[model samples]
Target: MNYAPENSESAAAAVSAIRQMIETGKLPADGRLPTERELAAELGCGRRTVRRVLDTLEAEGLIWRKQGKGTFAGQPPDPTGALAAEIAPDADPLVVMEARVCIEPALAELCALRATGEDVQRLRKLAQRASHPMDADTAELWDGALHRAIARIAGNRVMLTAFALLDEVRMGADWQEQRHRARTPETMALYETQHRKIVDAIERRDGAAAFDAMRAHLEALSDNLRTSIRTLDE
Candidate 1:
């Protein structure tokens, strides 16, 4: 893991080394990488430099880091695939929101009907995480996870694939910027409450209630986004 210098050159070298390891089958898909401290020591660099490299890799979807779990190699890109082409870099945030409003409520209804006890438990845990998010970014991440979990519990591969694609679209820089603009502390608190309502409805096995709760949550989010866009325009 020995790298070049302690400058930008070193950071680039670190990224290249890690990328090569992943590409060369040295790091299998979803395989955990060494911890930041270990990487820093091995590469003869500071933790800050390692962190910057990790951040860059994560942002590029080359890797993902869990809060406590170490970073893992991301799934390889499918550049030639329809999904990659569908979610364009400049896709409209409003279009993404509209798609969510249409699809997620139905998914929640299905989840309420189909979810197992384990699914309910996991949903509860995700809701708790969203309730106590550390910052705007963490709040958004948990919020997306909660919705995605509900979609997964619905047990429809088609809907799940659509949801996953929508998620990929959401990871775009434009969408992230728009979401960051909209995610105020007050809005996060409101979303936490809404998330609880949706989870509670699902736990009760009330499909209708779950559908309504999810629809309400997304509608509120859409409103917030509109307000944020207007403010930004102003």
Candidate 2:
């Protein structure tokens, strides 16, 4: 947990410590790391040294970072993230919803059947974070996390890649703005209820119920989004 740095080898020491953590599974794949400040403190090094170490690790494909999201301890997420960004401008939200309606229910069903106790626990925590989001941005973040958790727990690499692509597109600024605009108090409540239903079904290990709940939730989202867009056009 602590590393002593020689004069010019502080960055090297930090790198070794992080690499050790990764190798030992102390930092699991797709796991987020502590902030630069936190890492500096924990590693007994300067923030600059930590930064350099992170830069090295990132270039070596041992870790990756998103601007606002913290660094993660794995190879990057789906390579399609870049491609998603390129096509985001042309990706219709309704079309994306159609895809979700097709894919997410299956993920939910699989999650219900396959999720471990820890997975269900994490899902509950994510659901709670989403239901109590303080602002639109927070809501979007936790809500997306909740859905992604389900996909990950489903344990299908191919489906997860497809879902990740859609996730990246949905993270587009324009799409987020539209989603925010579409929000209303009643709609938020409905979403919260829907989220609860889906998580509950998964917790009970009822695949059919989980599938039905997820499909219902996505359908509701599609209906609300469509109505919001129509109102804006009018």
C-alpha lDDT of all candidate models, in order: 0.85, 0.88
Each prediction's TM-score versus the true structure: 0.65, 0.67
1-234, model 1: which lDDT tens digit per residue?
434446898788888888887788776456888889888887777777899999999999988887777788884445434574565655678878898999999999999999998999999999999889787788778877898899999999988888877877777535677788898778888888999999899999999999999999999999999999899999
Per-prediction count of colliding residue pairs?
Answer: 0, 0
At residue 177, give the lDDT of candidate 1. Answer: 77
Shift of residue 163 alpha carbon in model 1, Å: 1.0
Task: Output the number of the lDDT-best candidate.
Answer: 2
- Candidate 2, which segments miss by more than 4 Å at Cα? 1-78
- TM-score: model 1 vs. ground truth: 0.65
Alpha-carbon lDDT of model 1: 0.85
- Candidate 1: clashing residue pairs, number: 0
Tally clashing residue pairs in candidate 2. 0
